[model samples]
Target: MRVQPLIAVEDIERSRRWYQRLFDCVGVHGAGDYEQLMMPGDDTFFLQLHLWEVHGHPNLEPAFVRPGHGVLLWFEVEEFDEAVTRARDMDAWIVQEPHVNARANHLECWLHDPDGYTVVLASPFGDVE
Candidate 1:
């Protein structure tokens, strides 16, 4: 089974562009209350963007009105430094600058998305040795 992560945002289009730039991916199901984003030449979507207060999902809005309280969306990127560069170019809110993560033994950059989610981009596991 594969795990597909979806986050609720205030503006789908804005978040779509932000994530697309961050991962250099595309929004297959673009511009709506919900969107499916996938990597280039990939069949499955890597992430999903859903508008809050819609979709009728339980605890989606008023039930749990937190943008990204306790969750962290982490992705392993092959081009770790380039990804960090893109994030910086986008003027993204950087939670932490790029650094070697001792626990994971890889490079990582922590950032905040448009919706206040903590998005962590890391190099492939064990890349640093």
Candidate 2:
């Protein structure tokens, strides 16, 4: 089974650009208000972004009032340090700094998207000291 995460954002364009820069992902499909983002070498979309206010719901502000209160968007990267540098350069909100995850046998860092969505960037633990 393939899992595709859909994120609701206040600004679609901003989120789209942020995701593209942060993950090195691409928007394979989308026109306005919505976009399906695919990771490198992946046929199916790994994530999707939609505007909070859809077209159908006229005069409706938003279907849900809360955004990313208890959710995490996890991702694994091959070039851990490079990815971290990119994130840092973008000035993305750092939820957690890079550290070794002994339990998971990997190194991980946490960040937040423009819309306050939690994202974890991890790489397999290697002898890099």
Candidate 3:
């Protein structure tokens, strides 16, 4: 079985560029209003980004505009420091700076995406100083 998470974004292009700044990957499919991003070494799941309005339903209103209220799109990365640096360079909203989490056994840095989605960047304990 495979699991893919689809996120509704306000602007597809804006969100696409935002994600590209932080990740070194490409969209495997879709265009314009939707795209699926694929991480080279990680195949467990793919992230699908879509516009707030469903395609072919021009008159329909969006069901969810305010995303990530209680959701966290967490990513376990090997390049923890690089990730943090990129996030800062991209001017991403820093929810939490890099800090050790004893309970989680890792160091974490939380950030907000262009659409206000909470993204957690983390590395295993002792992975980086």
Candidate that would win on TM-score: 1
- Superior by TM-score: candidate 1 or candidate 3: 1
Q: What is the C-alpha lDDT profile of model 3 across 1-129, one tens digit per residue?
A: 766877888888788788878877666665888888888676643788888767655523565446766789988888888989999998899999999887777889999999889999999656644
Candidates 2 and 3, the one with greater TM-score: 2
Candidate 1 per-residue lDDT over residues 44-110, each given as its tens digit = 9988899888968865675354578899999999999899999999999998999999888999999
Task: In candidate 1, list every pair of residues with a backbone clash.
Answer: none
Question: Any idea what lDDT model 1 has?
Answer: 0.89
CA lDDT of each candidate?
0.89, 0.84, 0.81
> Comparing candidate 1 with candidate 2, which one achieves the higher lDDT?
1
User: TM-scores, in order shown?
Assistant: 0.94, 0.85, 0.84
Question: Where is model 1 more than 4 Å wrong at Cα?
Answer: 63-65
Candidate 3 TM-score, true structure as reference: 0.84
Question: Residue 80: error of model 3 in Å?
Answer: 0.5
- Please give the lDDT score at residue 16 for candidate 3: 78
Question: Can you tell me which runs of candidate 2 are displaced by over 4 Å?
Answer: 55-66, 125-129
Best first by lDDT, ranked = 1, 2, 3
